[model samples]
Target: MEFYSFNKENGKQITKFNSNFVMSRIIQTDEAAHIGCMYLDKNGLVGYHQAVVPQLLLVLNGEGHVRGENDEYVRVQSGDAVFWAKGEWHETKSETGLTAIVIESDGLNPSAFMKLK
Candidate 1:
């Protein structure tokens, strides 16, 4: 078993459109496994990037769009599921009235990225 935690200011470390959000790490693996929860404002946009391990994005709030990997674009909404292939370039863009959460159970720790400010 592993322990992880997150504070209100932590989510600000990773924001969308400069909106305020919160984050929490529900689980973590001894090696390099972790989960993340996030909130994005309407029309929010997350930078484009890739990861060493594939990730899954589950919409827990409103709706949005995800673009990356060979210029592929996917639309997602609450109750929708998106698969992020490992090392596949990816970015997030939200239209008006959008919010969502993401999970990266790879080699990322919430405490390492959390922003206390």
Candidate 2:
């Protein structure tokens, strides 16, 4: 068993899509799976982008809104989970700050597992 925690003082600060956020990598495997924690400050925004791989965001604290390519926004709060499929465009914004667990993998293609023999 392994234990993990998000340490703000130690997490990597990343700026992308005009947003500033912190990420703490919990686990990353050569198999293309990644698990991490992300922190977004109040009024923080993650600009629209497409997911190269499948991704899941599990909200742990605070409130936020998620928008998809269609420009529709959905309210998200603590305990909410959102998923984005590969190549899906999405964005997020935090009105009251947000903390979330993120899981993603490049190996999530279901077509790759089809046995067409």
Candidate 3:
């Protein structure tokens, strides 16, 4: 698994048309993509399984732990993004609740836009 940042610090400030905000790019897929929000309640867990396609998990709120092929859990929180390659084993868990956006696609290539964490 690889970690990326989607925090405001990694985004581009937009001052066009009198708008003031930072835009953090996520992904662009050449193929079909599945995007969804994941809500993990306290003590919740997403069991270990091989990714059917490349996956990117973007933390939206709260904190949690993630584990990849090596089975070493790492802490993750809001603004953090985690990537797992297709066929890689991974899992997500939270002891204090967490919410995230999950993006899956065979054409995922996060490195092209996201900054490494």
Candidate 3 accuracy as TM-score: 0.97
TM-score of 2: 0.64
Ranking by TM-score: 3, 2, 1
- Can you write out model 3's per-residue Cα lDDT over 1-117, one digit (the tens) per residue? 999999999999999999999999988989999999999999999999999999999999999999998868999999999999999999999999999999999999999999999
Each prediction's total of clashing residue pairs, residues at least 3 apart in sequence or on different chains, is 0, 0, 0
Tens digits of per-residue lDDT, candidate 2, 1-107, equal 01123345435788888769877443333566788999989898888999878776767899899977786788887756676788889998998899998878865
Q: Which stretches of candidate 2 lie over 4 Å from their true place?
A: 1-31, 107-117
Better of 1 and 3 by TM-score: 3
Q: Highest lDDT: which candidate?
A: 3
Query: Which of 1 and 2 is the better model by TM-score?
Result: 2
Top candidate on TM-score is 3
C-alpha root-mean-square deviation, each candidate: 11.9, 13.1, 0.8
